[model samples]
Target: EAGVTQFPSHSVIEKGQTVTLRCDPISGHDNLYWYRRVMGKEIKFLLHFVKESKQDESGMPNNRFLAERTGGTYSTLKVQPAELEDSGVYFCASSQRGLARSYNSPLHFGNGTRLTVT
Candidate 1:
């Protein structure tokens, strides 16, 4: 199965510009998650999508950030009016539902989308 993939391995933009990062999860996987590690902070969960529906999004930083899963397949995370503090590595992961229940079936992360807000 193909693992999660993120686009533009890296991005750089001005403080007020908008940027969209894309993620493609493994085929047939029903669960997709978004995570990020900003500077020295611990990796934090941004949101989770069970298929095309957002099961949780409590961790989203602010109104400027948005996440979406269309057709229960690929997902996209958008940051509008970026800020210097937005620089970080964004990761996407997916797993088979039943198998994912086990700790062994950990989320498969992409190399990560590195965004640099100037």
Candidate 2:
């Protein structure tokens, strides 16, 4: 079984530009999550998606960020008019359906997409 994969390991863009990050989680995994660490801060959750529905999005910074999981297969995070504070390492993780809410369930993470906004 392959692990999660994120495209464009590194991206550099202007402050007002748009950037989109893609994540392909492991096959058969039903729970997908987006997380990020900005400016050396600890990783923080951005959102959670179960299948094609969003279960949580409390950690999302603002309205400029959008997350989608179409067909419950792959996921995407688009940041329109990216801000300097949005620069960070965005991580994608996934686990089995019901296991996600359990403490013992292991989440497989991608290599992460590093975004730099200048």
Candidate 3:
């Protein structure tokens, strides 16, 4: 019954530092997703996980970003050698399998992990 949850709500780091963010989805949810907003740009999807497998990763910006949802549970997003351009709020969301697969239901999102790379 819990909603999505993210850890280390805010992070500040110098450029090139490594930062890892985490997300925990609600129980019984099989769809997990990551999205982010850089500066004042619109939020964009980063990746999606259906159970333990990655369903889509088309929106991930580049190789510096990595995302994972091991064992179909909590998820993590890591940015290596972070850049100033990467500073933004990273949001995690989840939805039920049936609703998600058909795109019928709205996603439930976490508060977001804000990272500032300077």
Instruction: For each candidate, give its TM-score against the true structure.
Output: 0.92, 0.94, 0.94
Q: Candidate 1: which pairs clash?
A: none
- lDDT for every model? 0.91, 0.95, 0.92
Model 3 lDDT per residue over 25-106, tens place: 9988899999998877999989999999999999999999999888999999999989989999999999888843577767
Maximum-lDDT candidate: 2
lDDT of 1 by residue, 37-114 (tens): 988889999999989999899989999999999899999999998999889999999876774365456688888999
For candidate 1, what is the TM-score? 0.92
lDDT of 2 by residue, 1-118 (tens): 9999999899999999999999999998889999999875899999999999999999999999999999999999999989999999999999986643665668999999999999
RMSD of each: 1.8, 1.6, 1.5
Quality of model 3 by C-alpha lDDT: 0.92
Q: What is the TM-score (0 to 1) of candidate 2?
A: 0.94
**Clashing residue pairs found in predicted model 2:** none
Candidate 1's C-alpha runs over 4 A off are 99-104
**Model 3 misplaced regions, further than 4 Å:** none
RMSD of 2: 1.6
